[model samples]
Target: MRIDAHHHVWQIARGDYGWRTPQLAPIYRDFGVEDLAPLLAAAGIGGTILVQAAPSEAETDFLLQVAAASETIRGVVGWTDFDAPDAAARIDELAEQPLLVGLRPMVQDLADDDWLLRPHLAAPLAAMARHGLVFDALVLPRHLPRLIRLCRRHPELAVVLDHCAKPPLKGGDLSSWRADIAELAQSPNVVCKISGLATEAAPGWTVADLRRAVDHVRDCYGAARLLWGSDWPVVNLAGDYALWFAAADALFADLADAERAAVFGGNAARVYLRRRGRGGSRR
Candidate 1:
């Protein structure tokens, strides 16, 4: 039941990836399930939650198609026009597909730091709450205050923070991010993903470079509220899948067996997959 709760797949030919430029050469090419299956196999990962790479309904539909075809993809965190007038209807339509486990509005890429607290997004968020969809917050540290407010505003919505809010590991400052993370964790409804940290560190970062942040997240959220993810291809920007996975394993090696299972797989299943009865096969 080992689950890599956050990862992505994209076809560069689709032209929707504005961020996938030549500068990110390590992962700029097309990456589908075929590219990831062996990596998951070698890591003993049984399933993954395929997430959206582009901010388009078409891309969401594309991810749904990929999830529908792949057994290993246990769930999908697709995109939708959360501010659209018809957002509720759009969410209802997507929810009919069953494999659509959650929705993510690329909040990190948006310029407004308080975008999560915008008045207009309330109705759409209510729609998501009604549909039992998780809100994957793709945010940065600056967005955390608004995120805390949003969680307080919608206590029913299951929100998960992606990439530890893209911490400033490279900047060597954990004080601010640590304080904010503790505040956000106060909400019983919010959870944090232990993924994508390596990519935020200094080039060729060792596991030691990631220890403080990882340890802090564990201390704040504990095993029950934490989940593991690979962030895959994007992880290639800092290191490869094997490197990050090994680092994560070493970081949590001291936990008791049950707690370790919850962090690595059970929490993701209970948060994302079990709600949809989409429990996938074990490796």
Candidate 2:
């Protein structure tokens, strides 16, 4: 199955999405499975991993409900208060829902870049590892070193680095981003997503504008460790789904078909759908 490994669906009135303001008018409206299914079909994508856009467990529950009712949503990356005292119990509860595959804390939005490394997070993180849940690192270039440390601390936890740490393609030198990403990739348990690059680039970006970062990530993580995601609706701010998908295809043109398949689908199935400790398919 060809998979778009990352994307989001939301209702505007949910009110938990504090970041979704009028400024992001292009994507500030509601987006649901009905809105995305046609685009997925148009791109020949068979399924998708629905990701959370808000920080509350309420939104996670909302997403789980959506996944339960949708055939195309294979898994969900939800959010929860990792620092909550009952975090482990909460994860255990969420894990009971088969579609819950991962968790993201919106690290990039926090004032403290090092917030994820807090000692309190250890227990919740351990629970995630115990359940075979993925740690979706929604971070920036500056967070890579800390992320590397986290990966070391929880070697068993599957970490998916979102958008190649949101490379600094829009501004400053990429030397720092490149070096840190290379180090992060050395952790075999971590995987990287080639998503959201278009929005990180200067507006009206072409395939060439993103090639350097894409090539660097491919070289560091290899095709097998890289998963392709559209980050749709969000992608609409830079370009539509077809535009980003086409650019991704062009950039990956030299890869063998099997390698492409892994990035587009196979890797996601292996990482998100197969539960650990539980010993069964999440599907």
Candidate 3:
């Protein structure tokens, strides 16, 4: 099945999404599976990995509930307080949800560039590694180095890097970002997602504008390690679902059919849903 490896469902009334303020008027309201269903159908997508938008365990539970009722939601990447004293137990409990395939910490919004390296995170991360869960990294360029270090620290952890570390497409100079991405890709356990780039680029970005970054990532991670995602409503901030999907399709036109399939669905299945038993780390 062709899976949208990354996308989100949120309810404004949930009140946990502090980032969902009045200023971001485009997606300021609730968006559920019903809202995204048609878009997925039009794109010929069979399933999706429903990702978390808020930092609360309530939101994570909310996402798992949504996935439980939906046929198209193949998996869910939820969130929890990674530093909580009982984080390992919390992870064990969340892993009990059959549809819950992964967890994310929303690392991009944090003030500290090295937050992933904190000593307290060790047990929680190790717990996640123990479960057959994927670690969905929501990070930016500055966090890549620390992320690389974290990957080394937990070599058994199955990690999927969200948005190719969300490169600064708005910034013309990507030399540093490129270097970091290349270095991070060296870790065998790390996989990269080709999602959220449109939101990171200048408004009205086209295939040409995204080509260089996409090409660079393709070169570094190759098709086997790369996964495609819509980034959906957040994608609406720059362009709509069809636009980003078509753009990604066009950008990867040169790849072989099998390779393209890997990016769109196969890789995601392998990373997030393949071995869903205890200690299901991909590497």
- Please list the residue runs of candidate 3 whose C-alpha ends up more than 4 Å from where it truly belongs after superposition: 277-283
**Decreasing lDDT order of the candidates:** 2, 1, 3
Q: What is the lDDT of residue 80 in candidate 1?
A: 92
Model 1: per-residue Cα lDDT at residue 51: 93
Task: State TM-scores per candidate.
Answer: 0.97, 0.97, 0.96
Q: On residues 183-236, what C-alpha lDDT tens digit does candidate 3 reach at each position?
A: 988999999999999998998788988988999999999999999999988998
Show model 2 residue runs off by greater than 4 Å.
276-282
Scored by lDDT, model 1 comes in at: 0.90
Per-residue lDDT tens digits for candidate 1, residues 1-283, read 8999999999999999998899989988999999999999999988899999899999989998898898798889999988788888888888887888899999988887878888988888888888889999999998898899999999999999999998899866778889999999999999999999998999989989999899999999999999999999899988899999999999999999999999999999999975555555421
- lDDT of each residue in 33-105, candidate 2, tens digit only: 9999899999999888999989999999999999889888888999999878899899988887878999999
User: Residue 113 error for model 3, in Å?
Assistant: 1.7
- Candidate 3 versus truth, CA RMSD in Å, comes to 2.8
Candidate 2 residue-wise lDDT at 144: 90
Model 2: lDDT to the true structure:
0.91
The residue pairs found clashing in candidate 3 are: none
